[model samples]
Target: MTEIKFYRVNDAYGYLSNFAPYPFEINGLIWSTSEHYFQAQKFLDKAIQEKIRRLKSPMDAALEGRNRENPLRSDWEVVKDDIMRLAVFEKFCQNPAIRRELLATGHATLIEHTKNDNYWADNGDGTGKNMLGIILMETRKRLKAE
Candidate 1:
């Protein structure tokens, strides 16, 4: 069976917002893109949406929220959990159902240039850390054992 993985935070973000090759089943519904999944599972919650709206850009906030050095840490701190959920959902949204949905939505652009490559594979310079992908792999292992 093929495994799903996401490396960089941006790579996760891209997979959520742009493209993905897998589908994730969450909350009893299959999600193709993290964007759709998160929005439905996380963002639609009134409290979470209120917190996310406080940020200038949800995407930028997720990227910044990953690091303590964000100048907007004060704002991000309030919604940190939501941001992280969005980031992590990339790994969950990996199933055949998602691929079918991506095609149905007419947004499945998992082509060459559109693929999120920063951590999907190797960096052009041969230096990269697939932090998110690594975390997901271990998490999957633990869940399967239970």
Candidate 2:
């Protein structure tokens, strides 16, 4: 499902705006802006991607432990746990208003990309980090642009 959200912050940390107290409910109804719409979309996509990469790292580590006799089976379990971890991460890191939307979507979507590589290709964060970094980066860009 395509996400639609609007953000109005006086300051990234704290600024000033004509917006009133209840911002989340603003919801493109009473007010809306396209720049915010695009930034939110980009930031959300980046955040979810980062979350997937971060979650898959431990699974990779689990598979690498050949010293453990039954590594393959252990790795499979790790893969399952990795997915749950990403869900928790996404729920915790996502905005409160969107949390329900995310949770109700795919509960067990596999990670298509990781920090290591995927489908014989290396297309990932490459640098391990949580979704915070992406949110912060996009927040900075959005704040600066406005």
Top TM-score hit: 1
* RMSD each, Å: 9.7, 17.5
lDDT by residue (90-114, candidate 2, tens digit) is 3223344433333333322212223
Residues 12-110 of candidate 1: C-alpha lDDT, one tens digit per residue: 334433234344555454444443333333333444433433444435334433433323324543563454354344444354443333333332222
Query: Which ranges of candidate 2 are over 4 A from the true structure?
Result: 1-115, 119-146
Candidate 2 clashing pairs?
Answer: 10-15, 11-14, 11-15
How does each model score on TM-score? 0.32, 0.18
lDDT (Cα) of model 1: 0.39
Assess the local accuracy of residue 81 in candidate 1 as a C-alpha lDDT between 0 and 100: 41
Worst 10 residues of 2 by lDDT: 13-22
Error of 2 at 73 (Å): 2.5
User: Which lDDT values do the candidates have, in the order given?
Assistant: 0.39, 0.29
Worst 10 residues of 1 by lDDT: 105-114
